[model samples]
Target chain A: MRQSSSTTDEKEIRETVAIILQNFSPLKENLIPILQSVQSAVGYIPQPAMKQVASFLAVPAGEVFGVATFYNQFRLIPPGKHPVKVCLGTACHVKGGNIILEEWKRRLGIDEGGVTQDREFSLDRVACVGCCALAPVVLVEEEVFGTMSPSAVEGILLRIRIEKERRSGCGGNEE
Target chain B: MKTITLTIDEKTVEATEGEMLLWVALDNDIYIPNLCALKARPLPDANCRLCWVDIEGRSAPVTACNEPVYNGMVVKTGTERVVRLQQTALELILSTHPVDCGRCGKNKRCELQKIARHLRTKLKQKRLRDISKRLPIDSSHSLFSYDPNKCVLCGRCIWVCKEEQKVGTLHFAYRGFAMVVTAFGGAPLGEADCTMCGRCVEVCPVGSLIFKNAEK
Candidate 1:
């Protein structure tokens, strides 16, 4: 059953690539946009997807892979439902950003750049969020939490839990 | 190409007009420490930032790898300021690179060792914190092995693989200090679609990529 499902996924990726490639003229310059469109359609760039991009762009597969890796914007794996980005820029670093990062790691049970087993949260260390005045910033999805401390992180978790309970109309240990 | 004359280290040399100063200096038997500038590359990568030189009219030192030479241009490769900047660049590279010359196959022949000796600086950087990642070594390939921690990210290997060999097996992934040469999706070299041309091994400047036969 798993093997058959994987084959179906492969077929889906190929069809997605074909649809995206129709918008591009197979020029080397269009590779990035093609990859971007592919990612938007499929959530992440799978290994087989890279081969499809290579063949469409008429570039080597390795070159496409190299380009994908060189840029920080690309991700090979699927992002979590909630991305937890901890700012580690120069200003945030001086403001004890690592301590906040550690607190998040402990609370979430995951290290930097890892998604939780449940696929709800993923942690990443960002270079900067461009708001230096709000040093030691943490972005939970689209919302930014600034001037963060360990206690503040706990409060944020509690809020998330409360919000979840309100949405589900129930609260339990499973959450 | 038109021929132009330039003075480097009190020695006059004739070089192609609009040629990069780094190659002209090296071709004329004048040494300027560099790790990223490749003769085969049409444009200089200048990622290493170790080829500092002072031209007569410039206020500060400039990297010789990209600077164009003109007729009668006076260049100084070993000024006090030039050496200091070069030393700082080498130190920054060493801060993230492991310094184990004794255990490395490229020990004596390593460009890092040669640059350090030239600059009279220690391989173990003193100022910067060691932010080196302990990435797993890929010994999967039968002919060569890769230790990402030892890589300097010179782009020579990548350029040689992608352009010269047209293999495109090796590539850089990530950003900031986390950037590293990797196979697609961080696959092991043996498992990747590598042709085993061994050109990447030949272009590696440090102990990052070593031939299996050369291992002790």
Candidate 2:
């Protein structure tokens, strides 16, 4: 049953990928655009989709993967429902951005580019969010939390939980 | 492919006009220290910054790898200014590279060692403070082992894997000091779609990648 379901998932990916790649000619210059399109369409660049792009472009799978991993803009892992981006810019790094990142990692029990077991949160780092005045900044979904500290991570999570509870009418959200 | 005559270290040599000066020099038994000049990569990465040579009519020394051979071109490989520049570059590379040559797999065969010997500099260069990345050794691949700590970021392995072999299994990821040669999605060599071709192992200039049989 698992194998059959996986094959279907693969088939779906193949179709979606084919559609996304149809507009893109097999030029090396179009590689980035194709990847971006597929990412926006599929939420993340799945390994299979990456292979399809590689084959379409006639580049090695590893080179494609290399380019994918080289840039922070691209994400290989699927983002969780609540995606969190920690800014580690020069100002933030000085103001303990790493500490806040560590706190998040400890609380979530997952490293960067990882999702929680419940898929509620995902963690990733950005070079600079251009919010140097608000050093040590974090973005949780659409909301930006600046001057972030290690101690404030729980409060952020609590606020998220409260927001969830309010959205789900208290009893709708399960333990 | 016009054959051109150029003077490197007072020695007249003939090479293809568009051929890189570093290769020309090496071909004619004129040794210019280089770490990143793969014959396969036409455009030099110039990341090593070690192959400095003084070309006449140019005030500042230029890297030999990036300089193309031209007719009547004169190059001084070992000027006082060139030596200083090369030494500083080697010092910076050594700063990040773990220099325990005694226990290293590529001890005698290492390019860093050869360059240092040719340049007449100490391997344990004391000018720069050490900032080695002590990443874990990936011994997962049955054929070879990879120690990121020992890598010099030469891009030789990456070029061989991606360009030459068309495997693209290994490549540079991240930026600044955090940059690393990682597999697709940062997977291990064993788990990645690597064909166990061992080209990456073969092209690595340092002890970063070594055949399992060659490991101590």
Candidate 3:
């Protein structure tokens, strides 16, 4: 994943903090929900939001940020336009989801849990999205694809590339 | 305060003043299966999808535990989708859980056993059974024994341990399916600074954490 300066824009930081405060009240034991809301509001958690959440929850800001970054679920970088989640849960792992994850890395030319240099895609692994029945699951922009294969990954990546091209007003087959 | 009228099992029921759909259906005697939800503390962690329901407006099966009641909501509590998701969630929870319910004290009283019976779910699917690596069961305490293998990560123990007893000894140690509720720093239950309060055992819906004195 690409890294931004630790000092984020103050306006965007305030907006993200405001969204978190709106989602959760300043009640004790609201830390989990507050962190979740903040992550959902801003694609990735900002350090400033962690400070605000710490003040709101009365916990140490370092503790809040530590907890936020502690879990693999939270991301510090702004994700790409499309988020690709590969299920690494037990069932899926047994069914070769990790292999599919590697395919994504190869096609995207980035490591797992890292975003492409162009920022067209961000790849992350999830413990499970509760879709184990659809083993070897991969989620692309909230849409779940089951039993994904290495061959299938190319098609999906090509589709995303084509969409990116279209959005930029460039003709298809430009890749 | 907003009110919502929704259909549960084809019966129209009204929920007032911000009620969870699971409670609404349960109030109307419409069975929306759940394990993580306790009447005492109702937070829609949505960790347990047993109360999964098919909502008209939602794309995927929205967990009744977490989803707020909306007006004119057409909810299906026992539809094919609900059954599939519920079965999946239950199966996932049971997969990692220890398979010694028959010998356990809460055999009949176990919520996991009851849910399996209710759903008529057989363990047909493949599961992760690694009994060789067990979390050390702490039965030294006079009140109860802690066996983490049977835990389903429902967070009920943590909820009750922290909320009712004001004992934050227990927390979700790991993330995702690897999650297990444990004392801070992986201390044994008795060794931890816990007050030996049995609220956790009392609130546990499953036999994961249980009263040792009650066992045969």
The model with the greatest TM-score is 1
Model 3 per-residue lDDT tens digits across residues B38-79: 766766466777887888867888778777787787888777
Candidate 2 chain A minimal-lDDT segment of 10 residues? A166-175
Tens digits of lDDT, candidate 1, B154-176: 99988988889888878887778
DockQ, prediction 1 = 0.55
Model 1 ranges off by over 4 Å: A70-72, A80-107, A120-175
lDDT of 3 by residue, A33-77 (tens): 877777787777776677688778875454464466558878877
Model 2: clashing residue pairs?
Answer: A62-B168
How do the candidates rank by lDDT, highest first? 1, 2, 3
Error at B16, model 1, angstroms: 2.2
Evaluated on the second chain alone, the candidates' TM-scores are 0.97, 0.97, 0.88
Higher-ranked by TM-score: 1 or 2: 1
* Candidate 1 structure quality by residue, lDDT tens digits, A31-107: 89988998889867888999989987877787788777766667677667778899999999999999999999999
User: What DockQ does candidate 2 have relative to the true complex?
Assistant: 0.49
**Candidate 3 residue runs with Cα over 4 Å from true position:** A1-175, B1-4, B123-133, B176-178
Which DockQ values do the candidates obtain, in the order shown? Answer: 0.55, 0.49, 0.05
